[model samples]
Target: MNYEFLRCDIENKVATVTISHSPGNKLNTQVYQEITQIMGELEANEHVNAIVITGEGEEAFVAGADINELADLDTVGMMDLTQITRTSYSKIENLNKPVIASINGEARGGGLELALSCDLRIASEYAQFAFPEINLGVIPGGGGTQRIQKVVGQGTAKELLYFGETIDAERAYQLQIVNKVVDQNELSSTAKEWARKLAQKAPVALRMMKLAVNTGANVDLESALTIEATSYDGSFATQDRKEGIAARLENRKPNFKGR
Candidate 1:
């Protein structure tokens, strides 16, 4: 389906969703709604193994929410928005397939938070990031508070959020906020390369791996271990597991059906 605020291209087992609203691609209410719908559609497609999210141009991934909308929002409006953003982002985070944020340009405020919700983030050398809510007399009301902390630790997350500062791609890499940094020209290529590799693996095992990391990171040691143990055993119970072993013995690559 065609979208007014986004561009979607599905090739092989990967779907690339590009936020395409303008020179800066600011995320508006319509954009947010459509993005959630597009992701929902992708999630239901068995042929889609991975998703890459990026912006349309090199200027900015998303400059943040449309300033006009944010200015007019009352307390009730804010609460409603919080629910929408939280639910949409959580759905993306909990999706069975992996999602990668291809940070091709500036990812400020909500944009950065959206990228943070993804399983992995890879940035172009020219990409920049910031949580500038403080600049507007507000703080990140999105999952930025919790998710950013997990990706970059409490200290850096606090400093960045408090200062409302922008960091270059290199600095983000040093902080481990992004998994990898590559040349601007190679950003999309690198993301697709990673997605392609992930698509070749057993889908069930990948889902379990994602579950182990996401759920295990939030609990006590005993609970985390319990989650990890279940994930390990769950992967072993898949039909693909037996195929993998048998294929190894037969000197062939296993064909996984996501069973």
Candidate 2:
């Protein structure tokens, strides 16, 4: 399918979605709509097992939202925009297949929020992260406040959001926001490597694992354990489980059909 704001390329069971708005790749209403639609398509595409998200240029992963688009909005319009943004980001976070953010450069405001929605983040050495919404007299509305706190803890999340200060990739790694940091030249290849590795795993098991972790994160310990156990038990019924065991005994590589 054609997209106005992004490009989706699939290879070796990995789908890479590039935000192609150019320059800063700032998110506007069209970007949000395209993201939502593309994510849904990727989720339903049987051949896709992993997904990667990144921006088009060298200067920014995504600089922020389209400030020009936001500048003319009334209160109701702002609410509508935030709702769409939140829904789009939520789709990324809850995708059955794993999603990785290959953050190449600056990620500020809604851009940082978008990265936070991914299952994992791999940032380039030149990448920077911030929630600069406060500068515009607003706060993050696209799950940033909640997701960042979950990843980096409350105090650090508060500091980043309140002060609207940008942190380098190293600092973000230290804060546990990004899973890994590499040179800018290696960012795309590294992200693809990880995504391909993920694609080679048992799809059903990975889906259950992701489901368990995402769902359990919000519940009590006992409830979380119950959810995990349920997911674990459900995995045993898949054909992939039998193939995995048979391959182990035969000393051959397992062929997973995502069944």
Candidate 3:
């Protein structure tokens, strides 16, 4: 499908979705719509085993929301916009395949929120992150406030949110917001490499693993154990499970067809 603000390309079972806008790749209504649409297509595309999201230029993964759009919003408009944003982010967060954020540069406000929705984040040395919505006399309308705390504890999230300060890639890695940080020149290659590695895993098991961890995280210990048990039992029923075991016994690589 055609997109005005987003570009998608698939290679080696990995889909790379890039957000590109003239000024800082800021999130807007159209961008959100295109993202959700692209994600839907990717979800159904059997060839795609993993996904990576990033910005067009090296300057920013996304600077924030488009102030041009935000500036024109009334209270009702703001509410509607926030709902759309939330739904779009939810689509990414709930995707069965692994989603990685190749954060090339600045990720602020809603941009940071977008990155938080991904399963993993790999930031460039020049990358910077912040929730600067408070500076605009508003809070992060997306999942930033909640997701950030889940990844980086409440105290750190509170400090970052309250101060509206930008943290460098290293600091973000230290806070566990980003899984890895590499030199600016290595960012794209590193992200693509990681995506390719993830694509090599058994597809059904990868999906189940993500589901088990994400679902378990929100429940009590006993409930989490139950969720994991279900996932574990479900995996054993797949043809890939037998192939994996037989390959191990034969000392050969397993060929999982995602059965």
TM-score of each: 0.96, 0.99, 0.98
lDDT for position 172 in model 2 = 97
Model 3: per-residue lDDT, tens digit, 1-259?
7999998889999999999897999999999989999999999999999999999999999999999998999999989999999999999998989999999999999899999999999999999999998888889989999999999999998999999998998999999999999999999999999999998889999899999999999999999999999999988999999999999999998888899
Cα distance off (Å), candidate 3, residue 55: 0.3
**Candidate 2 lDDT for residue 60:** 92
Local accuracy of candidate 1 as per-residue lDDT tens digits, 124-194: 99999999999889998779989988878899889999999999999999998899999999999999999
Please rank every candidate by lDDT, starting with the best. Answer: 2, 3, 1
The candidate that achieves the highest lDDT relative to the unseen native structure? 2
Q: Clash pairs of candidate 1?
A: none
Give residue 142's lDDT in candidate 3 (0 to 100). 93
lDDT of each: 0.89, 0.95, 0.94
Give candidate 1 regions above 4 Å deviation.
none
lDDT of 2 by residue, 103-205 (tens): 9999998899999999999999999999998988989999999999999899989999999998999999999999999999999999999999999999999
* TM-score of model 2 vs. true structure: 0.99
lDDT of 1 at 184: 90
Q: How many pairs of residues collide in each model?
A: 0, 0, 0
Which is better, 1 or 3, measured by TM-score? 3
